[model samples]
Target: MRFYIQQFIRTIMMAVFAVFFLRLHVTGELARYVNPKYDGMSQLAAVIFVFLTFIQFSRIWKSKKDNQAHCSKECSHHHGDDHSFLKKVISYVILIFPLLTGFSLPPQTLNSSLAENKGTLLSEGQSLDIVQESDDHQYFPAVENTDKNHNEKPLPNNNYLQEEAYQKKMKTLEDVHSIDMNEDIFSSYYEVIRASPRDFVGKNITLQGFIYREEGLHSNQLVISRFLITHCIADASVIGLLTEFEQASSYEKDTWMEIEGTLDVTTHNGAELPIIKAKRGRVIKEPSNPYIYPVLRKMTD
Candidate 1:
């Protein structure tokens, strides 16, 4: 009887897990806790949960029909060695508490308070080459009516090699100069700014994040920050850029805001850091999906 009861409980727990994942994915709350790249994996796990529940239910049904038949001497001996009542109760509590909480409370994004606790990663300064190249490559106007003596000495023997090198250089230059802080590339912009703060100096940027102020920050200094989660909320880390605004004190901590500014390099605690000198700022509602997923390759590397 106890075995059948335990199997029934296990089946219900599996169903709960499956339902939790489905609800998170359907409501789009999964992104708040984990990177979207892993959404497929979560769905796969949910399917597995449903499959296990089916297997558990089959076992429970089989046990019920054969209760008397399976009561052989060996079965009796094994059942006598079942886990203690206290241990069984503890296991059930461990499985049910999280499911209950997930159902009862609303999902939340990591905010400024959690940012302070996790600590921010925005202090290093590295040199970056900011070379700009025209995207359009048009052939230089062919020399017209040039003197024979100055005629472009039939193209060099390594002309193809030189052309390839030039194209490669132009591609690199284009990448270095491009910095977009829109929703699609917010995390990429953050990575570039963190990796090489000096390269972005004087570039205009617009982004939204909660205000975070740490001890020792000047009255005018605050951070515009967001949480970066690769796997799940448990592993979330704070990434932000420092900002200086005269009226920073007017904005309460943890308030979401959209800020437009120019990137500037500044010194803080003897380390050069990227600071956004805000030109305009305004309060904004928090986004439904607040956590930013760092470029996966960069995060793994």
Candidate 2:
């Protein structure tokens, strides 16, 4: 009977987990914890949970006869053992805590608090080139072509010229720098700015993020950051741009805001870093899906 009861408890826990994912899916909140590319995996887990639940029910049905056969006072006394009762209580408590907390509290994306603890990337301007190397290769692959005949020497591919033209056009747009930050293009914009901060200097841009103030920052200096999650929240890291706003002290830590500004280079602790000179700022609600996902392909829109 105790074994069947334990199985039933486990079944309930599995169902709870299954429902948790379902809840996130239905409310479009799954993107907060994971990239949208992995949404199918969550659905698959829910299906597996349902299958396991059926197996648990089958086991419970089969155990009914054995439970009746061992229904004597001796078995009852063993089932009521203090140590066994304590173990069962512990097991249930452990299983129920996550489910209760998940349902009771609202789901939130990583914010300034987590950014402060994990450390922000805006200060690490020197490492931007290294971070962007792989991304550059991925986005701009080499163009190659071979001559069809032995008499003909290999000629440069016209595709290379076209790609060069495209890059030049992109650079011209970057120079204009009127950037609009949204879920689709956030990663791409971040990569560009980090890779070559000087190219974007004096360009007007508007973006939104939570406030993150690192140690030793001046009264006018604060970071506007968003968590970049590759897989899930466990591996989330903060990436942000520094802002120079005189009224920074008026906003509380972790407050969400939309900032419009011009990108410029500034020296902080002898390190040349990119900072936004704020022209306008306004408080805004946090986005439902706050984490910026890495772009796997070129963002055309």
Query: Scored by CA lDDT, what does every candidate get?
Result: 0.68, 0.68
Report the alpha-carbon TM-score of model 2 versus the true structure.
Answer: 0.70
How many clashes (backbone N, Cα, C below 3 Å) per candidate?
0, 0
Runs off by more than 4 Å, candidate 1: 1-3, 62-65, 70-76, 120-179, 297-301
lDDT of 2 by residue, 1-301 (tens): 3356666677778878888988988988777777777888999998898888777766654455665676775564544235666887987898799889889987776777777677545554332211111222122112122223322422211111244444654565565648776555566577778767887886887887889887766776788888777778888888888887667876788887778887777665456666777777777665556677765443342
Clashing pairs in 2: none
Model 1, position 36: C-alpha lDDT score:
77
Candidate 2: 10-residue stretch with minimal lDDT: 129-138
TM-score of model 1 (CA atoms): 0.74
Cα error, candidate 2, residue 255 (Å):
1.3
